[model samples]
Target: MTLSQDISDIAIIGTGPAGLLAGYETNPSLNDSQVDIFTKSSKIGHPEHCSGLISFEGLQRLNVSMPDLKKKIGYNSIRYAKLIAPNNLSFRIDRGTKAMIVLDRPKLDGYFAAKTRKRGCNLHLKCKIHKIGYTKGYWFLLMTNQGKKSVTKSKFLINAEGIHTHLAKSLQLPVPNHKWHFPAFQAVIDGVKDLERDCSELYFGQEFAPGFFGWVIPLNEESARVGVAVGSWTGNNTRKYFYKFLKSHPRLKNRLRKDKIVKTYGGIVPGAGPISRTYHTNYMVIGDAAGQTKATTGGGVNIGGFCGRIAGKYSKKIISNEISSKQGCVDYQKQWRAFFEPNLSLMKFFRRTLSFLPDKDWNKIFQIASTTGLEKNMKVTDIDLHGTGLLNYAFQPKVITKGLKLTPHLLLSYLRGVLPD
Candidate 1:
């Protein structure tokens, strides 16, 4: 059965962080508009992946309020970091304030989805968008569910479909080259008794996570989320290698009394760098789909939220005819780049250097960190990562010097590799 409907002013694909944020920002006053969201999942939040790590500023900026902090143990701070080296050298960072908070990933996404729904945004779950095409200045979307098909027409489209963007690829849009993708695997374990409450741990040894790193992010005292991310360049099955690494780690093995695996999740992280162009005609991409994730830390929630909000705000202008020129889309791209390009560029350089570094360097770096409080010195708030600028952290001399040295390398790499033709 075919049902024809008028084209919407905006159609958002994927109900993840970017899509939800866009919906909320578009009509903060809860005004009615022709907006529709489509998602393949049966529910708003399911099959959860992601470590759910964020900063205090991120929560505030995203307007997320968690009344039960204890329930969200994944939300914690890095009061101190202990970096262990091959030579047994360790570095520690003891900062008084909490540097990060981990959230319940599925719950957080659900919350965002709820907020979007409350604001009158139409949500279509379990709907798989198979093909998207444009004709006569209007975009057409073909979606199917349970042997049934439906069509959605929109004047503007936002692709928030995460790492795999079939719509953008179909149109031959300028997607970033997949030069530095990483495979990440995570599991929620229920019986870790000795995990720290306020601090998270990371293992940087090549043996543990070959092109990337391993982490134990505490959800609370009783349970923790353990995971590893390996760069694709390493050529290892991330899931298999992560389990092997977990079985070998004496510290992790000893604390595990029960091996009750709650869930297993894995996904690809696009670390190639942000897309050189985020917009084309009436379309834009955001979040992981746009390569907005941090290459160094694999963090994108804050950046994604910021970009989604910006996109939402801009969508109004496009709909209202305030900015009728193609330059409106260009303006959106420029604003997004202005906010995230620098940090992403720096992260790419750091990821490349770290990927190629010998295990000894990690050990040395950890050792230096243990003694010099380097982690403390370099502690950045979520806002800093989300275009707050580095000037706020300029007081610490060593951190400043290190960042300065890294800036040139990042800029050079961007120039040599990522600059638009």
Candidate 2:
């Protein structure tokens, strides 16, 4: 059908997991209206930007299944890690047998999109919705594809568009004060030299990635995804910092110097936190577009997907006339924030506190980790998408005692973020 011919009860912009899940659960096929999804990319998971690491536990929480474990889905598993400090102090962390895993992100997203389509949602890829307006209780959308313009309408809208949400502003909803982003660059390398095949590494120091941290995630013994995130206060040019990180770090240079760069991509991720408000008249926002990423790690797939499911369920209720669109919108924010806010707040604090520390402090932190057997805890536990796992670090007398001596303000900053606003 022509684009102009499209009409729906719910329209979703962007095809990320958040939008796909939202469309999947909110399919309006039962009624005269439909749950229609539109994406700017032609491929299922192209224009790849996100770091593709999801904990196995995260998969179960998303209610999705991987058809293959060692074959098609994830080819590598992480059980050992080297947490290197600025002073070359390192802490070894192993998740016993398997700590974390890497996903073929593009394939994963494509898999879900196909499943969502089969679930009865009309997913239009390479489809861009440029303009939106509300009139007579309907959202009029101006969509374009290959220079062709088509008009469509929907009673409700789901905004899963990635960072720098254009719709939230175009719709003139109450926007957030500012969007803090982690300027990051990632590349695929043929070999991650000198590092353990199953061990991932985190390099800490302002010199490495001023605001955030640097990482090496192994795809296999011969390949890995290497990247770094620079905080807003430090600078926005991650490429420059990435170069600095490569040349200065001992292991990174050894691994990357002789390796071929398979591919490289860069993007911005929501760093400050979720937007202040994520609801409007007949609209709801989810995913990176709404700052639904984990504050500590900048990963959003699982958390955003979980919230997207909530959005989908609520949209269905709104379509069924069981709740008003406005009510559904409010509930979307409340429910998502209820489950994530407290954790999110603590994470935001943790990230900020990390930024506040210097290389010496990082050295102290890892020193404690190595001596205190913190790595033992990680090797056996599952991935904590929300950063709750780090809480165990604070309970140690020696760790807390050293932390206070090194960075006394850390506690104050933690309190500021944790105390309800």
Candidate 3:
């Protein structure tokens, strides 16, 4: 196979948000350099599975524009979220602030791809990369499609191949430990009425979603994306629970009877941060491949875009020799960790503690959160390292009190690193 001349300084695997964002962040006029993106899918956004809920701030941070198809469901101010016990006791939370926009996934992905192409990145659809290796400081990519093969080389490689980051895993880059993985199932339903215009619904309890929670995010007046996520510890198939929950929940039973199913989808979410390392000598990983999704909420669009931008900028530095050391790539890892690690670590702690709590304890915590205003608590939980002393101010009391109460068990669990077999 002969190499393509258009394969420029960076070869990005996957044309999802991460790869697209990386391309957008690259300096376009760098001596007529090409940024080549390869994807196995012949069509972009064909197998859409994401819920696509994101904050307005997240969109701006990624520097990606919104599409016309996005319908404003109003701002979601979560006054109280409940964990309903099997016995029907409800633990509720009242958090302030709002969880913003629910997007159309296909539109969002297409928007990013278009922006990336407009920025002069070469996007190759249906291109499956089989192998990658570094030679004389240049990275070589071997790809094939339809029995035809091609080769490309670049100074750096960015692996944004979603959860199945084949290239990074082959190189033995630290993929997230599988124990932290949670499976999610989603389906879009139409013909619903009297649904909360702005509010998203979350059901957290062992009976409903043993390890994680279930959600109903309204996308428009008549349609909604309803799903359930089960932590790996529960040993439950999330897809099974998705149907079971609809069948069992009285409220949803009627809705299901009335609504027609439009789409059904499922995927695994890495409910943790990266495994200490996300970069090697000449390669970087982003998005689900790097486990950038939030532990508590399976949200990754923001984090993926943030890391993609960082990786894109760092790629430029590495190629330009502005920072001429292997550590330049390491610095990219550092930048992501500095921004995401602390919160993700804290969130992992919370996930552990919450998972072990009995129904009564969960009810108590939810009751406290409800009284405190969930939206406010969400803002605190969403805090990144770059943000204020707000984490200390907002969560110190809760951490010292509730957090300390769970410390001993949590410490043991953390050290054991034991997950369900």
Pick the TM-score winner: 2
- Model 2 misses residue 216 by how many Å? 1.0
Per-residue CA lDDT of candidate 2, range 45-104, in tens? Answer: 888887777776776667665555544456577777677888888877766554467777
Worst 10 residues of 2 by lDDT: 412-421
Model 2 lDDT, residue 306, Cα: 80
* Residue 322 Cα positional deviation in candidate 2, in Å, after optimal superposition: 2.8
Residue-wise lDDT of candidate 3 within 183-208, one digit each (tens)?
Answer: 88988888765666466677777667
Checking candidate 1 for backbone clashes, the offending pairs are 74-102, 75-101, 75-102, 76-102, 85-363, 90-370, 91-369, 91-370, 92-369, 92-370
Candidate 2 similarity to native, TM-score: 0.89
Ranking by TM-score: 2, 1, 3
Instruction: Estimate the Cα RMSD of every predicted model relative to the unseen true structure.
Output: 4.2, 3.4, 3.8
Of the pair 2 and 3, which is ahead by lDDT? 2
Model 1, C-alpha of 308: deviation from truth (Å): 0.5
lDDT of 3: 0.71
**If both were scored by lDDT, which would come out higher, candidate 1 or candidate 3?**
1
Give the Cα lDDT of each candidate: 0.72, 0.76, 0.71
